[model samples]
Every structure is written in C-alpha cells, then in structure tokens.
Target: MKTIAILFIAFCSTISFGQTEKESDIVINNSQQDDTYRAGETIHVNAAIQGDLVTAGGKLIINDSIYEDFTAAGGELFLNDYIADDVRVAAGRITVDAEIGDDLVVFAGEVILTENAVVHGNLKCFAGNIEIHGDVMGNLDIKGADILIDGTVKETSKIVGEDITIGSNAKFHKEVQYWSSEGQMDFKDSLVNTEAYFDEDLGEEKSELSLISLGIASFSLWIFYVLSAFLVILVLHALFKNAFSNAVEGLQNNLLKSFGYGLIYLLGIPLLIVLALVVIIGIPIGLFITTIFIFSLLFGHLIAALLLVYYYKQKKEKDWGFWNITFLALGIAIILRLLTIIPFLGILLSVIILSITYGALTLNVIHSKKQFVKT
Candidate 1:
C-alpha cells in the first residue's frame, strides 16, 4: 500500500514532464536513472531503471529491466522485461511476458500472461477477463468475469469468477479452490497434487447481492461526483478567474517551490489550527481557519484540474475560449476522479493535489500584496 501511494504521487507529480507536442511520445532508451517518472500520451521505456519506475499514459510499453518496484496506470500496458521487485499495474488491457522477482498485482479489463511470463512470487489480479499461460512459483489468487488458466502453479490456487476454466495442461502443486455459479468443474486427476474444493456458498452470496444493482449504484455515484466537480470548477472560474489564472501561472513557473510550499501548508496549517483551538480567546480564529481548510480539501481536485488544463494549454500553445477552458478543466477533473478509484492511491493523490493547489494560491496572494506595496 505504501508503494502504491508513492506511485500515485509520482504519477501526478510527473505530469509536468509530459510531452508538449501531441505527435511526440515519451521514450527512454538504454538510460539509467535512480528513479523514473513519466506521464504522456504514449510512453515507451527500453532503459534499465536502477530504482523505481512509475508512469501514467495513454499507452505504455516497457521492454527493459526495473531494479526496484514497478507501478503503472494507463490505457494499455505491455510488459516484456524483467522486474527485480514487485509489480503493480492498472490499465484497460494488460499483457505480461516478463519475469517478476516478487509478487504480481494487476487491475484491468483484460489481462494475459504469455507463455514466457514467470512470477517468482504470488500472483493477485482483478479483471474482466484473465488468461494465464505462464508459471507462478507462489500462490495464485484471481477474481474476474472470465478466467482461463493453463499455467503451472507451484502453490495453492484460489479463484472466483463467473466463468472459470482450467486447461488440460494446468498444473497445481497444492489445493485448488474455485467459486463459480456453474458449480464444480472437471479437472484432470493428475493436474492437482492435492484436493480441489468447490465453493458454492460464495457464488450464492454473490448472486444474493445482485452485482448489477451494485454496479449501477456505484456508477451513479461516480457520475454525481464528476458533475459536482464540474459545477465547482465553473463557479470558481466565474468568480475568481484572474486569481485562479495567476495562481496557476505561479505554479507553472515554480513547480518544485510550489510543491514545497504546499507541503508546508498541508502540514503546518493543521498544527496552527490545533494550537489556536487550545486557547479560549482564539477559538473563533481556529474555527475560521478550520472552515477554510475544509473548503480547501473539498475543492483541492478542482484547483488541481485548473492547473493541469492551464499547463496543457500553455504547452500546446492553443487559444482556448472561456467555455473551452472550463470544459477542459472538467475533463481533467473526470480523469482525476477515475484515478481515485484505485484503493490507497486516491488518498495519496488527494494529499499531493491539495498541497500544491493551496501552495499556489498562497503564493499568488503574497505576490499580489507585494505588488500592491510597490505601487
């Protein structure tokens, strides 16, 4: 979880490094870095990363080696290299044809582990469709809609899915436990060294909950959140257009400085508020500060979206009309909300965004006051 949080932070922080031109893709070839961070429309890495590799893009292909942990989120992902540590990926489609020294974790629409793929540690995945034809040296845990495993599992295997198929070539050293509405599946006697357990209760429980209803509810909430964020962005732009622009400009010019100031504000303001609350005479002051902090937290992503759109427009040199800018901001907000669907990642991203947004706003105010004094 800690590693996942770091990856999310890296993903957002590296947005500033994205390509300015649409036709150009971010590529790393035969290079070595302590840590790699990249965000773009398309990213291809052929380098040997000496440290962690974190990336977010439209499509990502890694054909090199990662010496440390690997974390990525994208539309499509292809892994054709070696990871010396754990790997965690979230994508629309994923293909793994590499060797992992540690655990393999994935969240996706479709996942395929080619014959060349090998996981030295456990394999845990959640997806819509999963096909495994590789070798897992440790335990295997999978949850999906359609699952077909023709791989070799050296340890126990646990699976839950709507449709589960174990190919004739599948080999399991330990017990194989599967839960499916179709009930027990026929497996070759020689395939499992131990027992095969069918979990009918799990399927019954799942059916009782009605997955369709749950999905609809969750999707509706997501829509509501996105629309609310869009409305907030429009209101903020309408009321404080100039101030917001200045803050984003300050953020653009001093990203690292803004991050530093943001971190201070995120951590320091709370301490000051707590100190103020300890005094009877300062209770009102503390309450006011608390209210402001709450508002900042509530609209952190909106401000971050504004900054992202502003940077994108500046980089592309596009002249966006008022409504166009708002629409762009809305799009960014939607993307941010989607990213938050990943567990643990959302909290970390929220913190980073809140810090940066408030930091930029504070800087803009300071700069404005200084200018007023000069005048």
Candidate 2:
C-alpha cells in the first residue's frame, strides 16, 4: 500500500512536467537529452534521447532516435526514427516509419506502419484502421475494423477485425490466427509457408477456441465489461433517468469539487475501514465498512457508465432529453473499455479514473439531497 501510494504520487507529480504552452511546442534538432517529458499542444522531437521519452500533446512527431523507452499520447503521432526500447502511444492517428527495437503498444483510430518500419518485439494495437507495411520480429496481436498486412512476421500473428487483407507480398514465418467476417477469406491459396486460422467461417479453422482461450481472455475482458455496462445502462436509463441526468450535470457543473470529494472517498474509506477493524466491539462495523468499500469498487464501472451516458445525452441539447441515455451510455462505455489495454503506469491511471467516477457519483448525491431539502 505504501509503495502504491508513493507510485501514485510520483505519477501525479509528473502530469504537469513541461505542460506549459511555450515549453510544449518543442522542436529539438541536433540536440541530446537524458530524458524528455513534456505536455503541449504540439510536440516535435528531432534529437536523440538517452533515456525514456514521455510526452502528450495534440500533435507529436518524433524524427530522432531514442536509446530507451518512448511513451506518448496525442491527437496524432508520427515516429520517423528508431527506438532502442519499447514504444507505447495512444493517439487518434499513428504513423510509424521508423524502427522499434522492442515491443509496440498502440491504441489509435488509425495505425499505419510504412514499409520502412519494423518491430523487434511483440506488437499490440487497438485501432479502427491498421495498415502494416513493415516487419514484426515477434508476435502481432491486433484488433481493428480493417487490417491490411503487407509485412513480414518472424513469429505468429493474431488479428481481430471486420476486414483483414494480407497483401500478396506479406509473409509470415509462423502461424496466423484471425477473426473476420463470413466471406472475407478469398486469398487462401495465395498464402505461402504459413498456417492460418479464421475464427468465423471465412476459412477452415486452423486451431480451436480451446487452444487460443488465453489470448482471447486477455483482450476480451474489456469487451465483456462494455457489453455488460451497456446492458446495465439500458435498464438504469429506463428506471432512473432523472438521476442519471442529475449525476452528469453535477459532474459537469462541479468538476473540481467532485474530483476533490472523489479523492477523499478513495483514500479515506480504506483508512476508516482499517481503523474500525482495530477493536473487537467494532468488528461488525468494520465488516460493514469493508462491505461498503467493496461495493463502491464494484459499482465503479456503473458510475462511469452513468457519467458517460449523462454527458453524451446532455451534449445533444441544453435542456437535455432523458430518453436516449441508455444508448449514450453504451457509446461512452465503448471508449472507456477500449482504454483498458494500456498498463504501463498502472495504479496512477486507475486512481485517476476511479476518482472521477466516485467524485461524480458523490457530487450527484449531494445535489440530489439539496433538491430533496428544498421540496
């Protein structure tokens, strides 16, 4: 717990590193830096980095090489250089025309690996459109709407998509597993020196579900959560329509206050529960506190779903219509659940999200009480 707290604090402190407008629009050319961490509207790096590079902005373009890990988030990212370590990025549009010495983790709307790109380690991507014209030395795990592979893979490749096209020039030294539509497997005979498995009836099944359950399990957890959240929202929207709208309005109206309350709830609850457990006479109380804490944790996703539903629906109009909150919640859940793939800076990310959800819920409850008192 102490370690988790320290890590969370450290992560929080790093959030504002070079976040100023002037400092963010950096274009480093013919320079060397030990480590780089910046947040801006636009970031451009053309110099070598000896250590890790962490940045976030509206637009990020890296034209120099890095000796260590590279992490970034932005509206769009373009990597035109090499990295000696792993690369993790979240962006709207991602274009990699360089080399990754290690693994690659990406969540984006569009991912394009130019012919010059290469990954020496594993590759994982969640995107709407993926076009790979490079080489992957390790396994490739990808989920997208459309995937076009004209690359070479030394290891296995797994893909989940609506439409998957393996260019005639694409080569895989090992097996390939994919899930696609019913009639998309029209190039079976053209595949050479490779075994392919299609999850649906697009082609013959190379391997059964039992063989790939682990891989599926790892990625499908988010999908399941999303479906479940959507279902719950449908019911909640129908029954507690006003409450959902109130929650959303409360959050939007009092972002800072809600976040503050959320922070308190997260840290204070655990301490209170532990203190209650210190006395024999308070055992039942401790148990009750523990239960409530656990319940809060369990309901975290629901709160998120509600928040999302409320925001999405309210944005359609100022007065806000309560009828379609369920569908709006589904849209929000889709986006939140998709972000579950990122795991590098673990607890801090979780804490940030939890705070927002808890805060929104608490703020709504407080406001609801004021209205009750007025009545």
Candidate 3:
C-alpha cells in the first residue's frame, strides 16, 4: 500500500481542484506495491504496481515506477517513469519521458517520445503528430498526421501519415517501410535500404465539392433503405409491441454509452491491428479482424439504435406499439446520420444525440423503469 499511496499523492498534487469537482471529476493516487487506481477526472501516480494499473480518467500523469501493466484513458497524459510491463493509453496528447519494458501502445492528439527514453518492445502509436527522440528495441509502428523519428529504431518500422522526417541521426537495424501523403516514402538522409509503399487508393485530386455531393447522395440512399426496412420490420413485429416499446425507452436512456462504444470501435481497430502484428503469426488474423471491423461499423450503429427503441417501448409503464417505437428510432437514426456529414458542428451534434439516444435505451433494458427513475 505504500507504493499505491505514493502514486496517489503524485497524481493528486498535479490536479487543480479538490473533492468539490464536478460529477464527472475523478482523482486517484496509488502508492503501494500493488497499485489499484480508478478515476473519472484527472490522475497522478507515483507508485509501483505489482499488478496492473487500470484507470479511466480525463487526464493522467504518472511519475512513479510501475512493475506491472498500465491502462489509462484521458485527454492528456505525461508518463515520466519506468514501466516494467506494457502501457496502453488513449488521450489527446501523450508525452513519454521514461523507460518501458514492454510494448507501448497509445492513441492521442500528439505523442512525443523524449530523449533518453527507451522502449524495449514494440511501439504502436496513432496521433495527429508523433515526435520520437528515443530508443526503440523492436519495431516502431505508427499512424499520424506528421511523424518524425530522430533516434534509433533497432528493428523494423512501419508508418502511415501525412508527413514524415527520418532524422540524419536516425538508425534502423532492419527494414523501414512507410506510406505517406506524398504517395511515396523517401529516406531524406543517408540510410540503409528502405522501402516505401504508396496507398493503393491514391488518385488524382478530385474537387472537394464532388466528394461532398457524393456523400449526400449516399446518405439519401441509406435513408430510403432504412425507412423501407423499418416499416417492414414494424409490421411483422406488431404482436411484440410491448417488448419493442421497452427497447426504445432503453435506447433513449443509454444512448451515450452506445455512441461511445461506436467511437471506440472506430479508433480501436487500427491500433489493435498494429499491436497484433508485433506477435509472430498474428498478422493474418489481425488483418482479417480489421476487415471485419470496417464492414461492421455501420451495421453496428444501426443495430444499437434498433435495440434502443425496442427496449424503450417494452419498459414503459404505458406500453407503446411496435410502429411507434420503431418509427421514432428510425427517424432519430436517420437524422443522426444526416447530421454527421455537416463537418465539425455536425460531429459534435451526432455524438450528443447518439449518446442520449443510446443511454436512455440502455437504462430501460438493464433496469426497471421505476428503479431507473429513482436514481
């Protein structure tokens, strides 16, 4: 427990607020031999974990020595310690200034591997930009907007991004294959034989307006198909009106989690693939997984919406008919899809609506309406 306490203190000292923080606010500190920490806001750690360090926070900073694995979720993270096991994190910005004994997998807005840092195993990263000035003993895989490697990569490396810079001092013991916006990879400085592949779908630039128009057309087609299908399903399931009604209510209440699940599915697939490829013979399975993910994303969203509607109607005190709940959910899903195409504001709106819709639905299905209402 000493190590856990130390970890807790280290994290708490960096946070700006106290216990009076918002409902979403969370803070954790673990200073013990076996660190166990969980939070919803910000976390600072200075502990040694004999077991895994699992956390779900808005921001995380670790400055201790951990003996086990660490998993965290946040908007920003700064890790400046020694981790004996693998590290997995999802944040907006991630800065590493320490040593990792195993793999380092991260998703963030920006990831910086500072000088003197060392990664003993593979490094898989996805972000807006990746700046590496450390040592990687195994392969360094990345996907980002801009990627700069100014240190040593002991083994192989693969990257996909908009811009890449392999510093003069950069050393690669094995092959380094990459893809970028230029349609080809270049070893700007002196280096061993490097292979750069181009994106197979790369083509001459088309007008942005053309793509936007096509997107609209696709949306319209989806709307038509959805409406037709919902009507057919509703008519067939008329006898199960109570059950369908309950599902709808559930969806309305728990829409948030469903939306979050969808977003996770979107960002998690590529990262998982990168990690899997590091293990020998896992490459084929990883690629197949990615293909399945791509094919299921839209279908998953649609199903989530449908499930929500069904729960809502069935759980209501005054039961609703199948058509009532089905139409409402279909309408909401169609609107959400349409809104997702509007750019920045649209994205935010879609998240909000989807979250609400799914959240309500989840609540309806998981618990009695009276019990849920009491909470």
Candidate 4:
C-alpha cells in the first residue's frame, strides 16, 4: 500500500507542476486544447477541451466540457459541465452537476451528485459523506461513513458504509448488496426490482497476526528503499564525479543562491511541463520532463546526504578520497533515514534538504551550460 501510494504521488507530481513563483496563483483556462494540465491555488476552466483535462489545485471549478477523461486532485472541486469520458478525482469536497459519458471514480471527504447530474457509466467512490440524488445508468459501488442515495441505479449496486440511507426517491433496477456494522438495512420492496445481499464478515477488522505481518512488510520495504537509495547515490557519484564536485563547490560558494535556484527549478519546471502538455506537438517534451522530475524527487534525499558529507569535509579541512567520501555519504544517508521517522519534523527536514541539494545541482548545470556556450 505504501509503494502504491508513493507511485501515485510520483505520477500526480509529474502532471501537477504548475505556474512559477511569479505567475498568478489562480489559473483560468478559456481556450480549446488537445490535452490540458494545470496546477495552481485556484483553477477555473470555462473552455471546451478537445482531449483530456488534468489539474491539481486548492479549488477547481469546471464549467465547460471535456472530450476525453478528466482527472483532478484538489481541496474543493465543482463540475458543472460535461465529461465525454471517465472522471477520476481525489479531493476534500466534490460536487457534480454535470453529465458523465463514462465511469465516475472519486476519493473524497464529502461528495454530492446533485439532481442535475447524470452518469452514463458506473459510479465508484470512497468518501466520508456521500449524497447521490442524480441518475446513474450503470452500477454503483460506494464506501463511506455516511451515505444517502436518492438516485437511480440502473444496474447492480454495492455499498459499504457506517450509516446508509436509501431515500424514498431511490430506485434500483437490479440487485443491491450492502455491508455495515449495523447489519442489513430494510428497503422498501418498490425501491428494488431485484435481490439484496449483506455480508457481515466483510466489514470486520483484521486479526492481530495480519496487522503484525503488515508491519513487518512495511519495515522490509523501508529497508529496501534505504539500500536502493544508497546504491543509487554511489552510482551517481561514480559516474558523474566531476559534475558532482562542481555542484558541491557551487554549494560551498553560495548556499543561499543555490537554494533560490533550486526553489525555482522545483516550482518552475512543473509549470513548463504543464504548458508543454497543452500542445499536441509538445507532448513528448512534457513526458521527458516528467521522467526527469520524478528521478530528481526519488533520489533527492540521497543527493542531499552527499552534499552534507562534502560540506562537512570542507568545514573540517579534510581531504577525503573517493572511498572515504562514499562511506561518509552512506553514513549520512542512514542517519537521514532514521531522522525521517520523527513524524512532521522529519518530513520538513527532508524537504529542506532536498531543496538545498537540488538548488546546488541546478546552479551547477546552468553554469556548465554557460561555460559550454562560451567555449
């Protein structure tokens, strides 16, 4: 599950890069496009997209139509338009008043499908609270804490929740299966055209042994991550010794400057990739950038460890050779890995270290390019 989550974050990061520090906090899209990618504090889409639409923001409002899939992650999301294909979203709160041509998949805290909404395909959701008063032409699969369904499910329905209520207006054309701690719920015969099933054991908690096994698995995965990261850093040092040295020198010379540049690269590159993805011809470039960005994020901490070791060596006036530096970097990486176990502080420290490391690296790269041009 952790690995899956990590991969999901990496994938989202690739597409969620948005405007630079100087750009507006809000993004407004009013033009047509083959594929659109946007990220900001707030996003408003009022155009007809010929292809897909992908966005990440704090608040997102879509008042137009999408010809293909629509994927988004944000705080508050409102869809008041038409989606030609599937809709996948993860957010805090989601309200849908549009027409979905395909499936609707959502992971949210609160979800509402107003009466004006119509889904041509299945509805799959995991939320804290869900209210569906619209029409679903396909099956309904939902899991939540509180659920109220007054909608029409044309096919089978499976719902799992703490509190489930089927409104008087609810109509099920097929079988409905539900699981809750309170047991099977009583539904009016008129509301269902088929049967209903309740599996009591499905909602039960896992056994102690299962939890222990899960803990062991998670620990093993962490160990693997640490070892792999160490190996990757060693390989990077071996293959790009000169380039790495130059970046360390740059960091030693101007720590603040490198950090500023790193901050820009961290934020600006994503925005550039988003823009590139908006154009059909620039799709390749966007994908390439995404790959490199993911790599940088994955190995960022190890890189930071290396930078720390080099900085320490410089401060101590030590002339450590390649092998000694390698050992020092390994030790630093282990210490960093351990420090990251302190909850919030660990995460904050990791981000700070990553920023510094990447900043130095980006500075060196730019300098190298300039020197190449001059030569």
Q: Write down the lDDT that model 1 would get.
A: 0.75
Q: Model 4 over residues 306-371: C-alpha lDDT tens digits?
A: 778777877787989865876688778778767765789988786677778878877776776687
Q: Model 2 misses residue 200 by how many Å? A: 4.3
RMSD of each: 16.7, 18.0, 17.4, 15.8
Q: Which has the higher lDDT value, candidate number 2 or candidate number 4?
A: 4
Q: Which ten residues in a row have the lowest lDDT in candidate 1?
A: 12-21
What Cα-based lDDT does every candidate model obtain? Answer: 0.75, 0.68, 0.61, 0.74
Q: Is candidate 3 or candidate 4 better by TM-score?
A: 4
Order of models, best lDDT first: 1, 4, 2, 3
Off by over 4 Å in 2: 1-24, 188-190, 200-375
Candidate 4 wrongly placed segments (more than 4 Å) = 1-29, 205-375
Rank order (by TM-score, best first)? 1, 4, 2, 3
Q: Is candidate 1 or candidate 3 better by TM-score?
A: 1
Q: What is the TM-score of each candidate against the true structure?
A: 0.55, 0.51, 0.51, 0.54
Residues 185-217 of candidate 3 have per-residue lDDT tens digits of 667653556544454432222122234322356
How many clashes show up in model 3? 56
**RMSD, candidate 4, Å:** 15.8
In the range 1-375, model 2's lDDT, one tens digit per residue, is 122222322322222231212233667776666887665556788788888987765678998889999987666689999999999876667899999999999867789999999999999987778999999999998877778998888898787776788898788788877788644465544356777776563223323322231213445654544544543344334334455556667777787887788899899988988888898888888876666566455445555766665676577664544435556557755555445335754346556667877777677667656766799
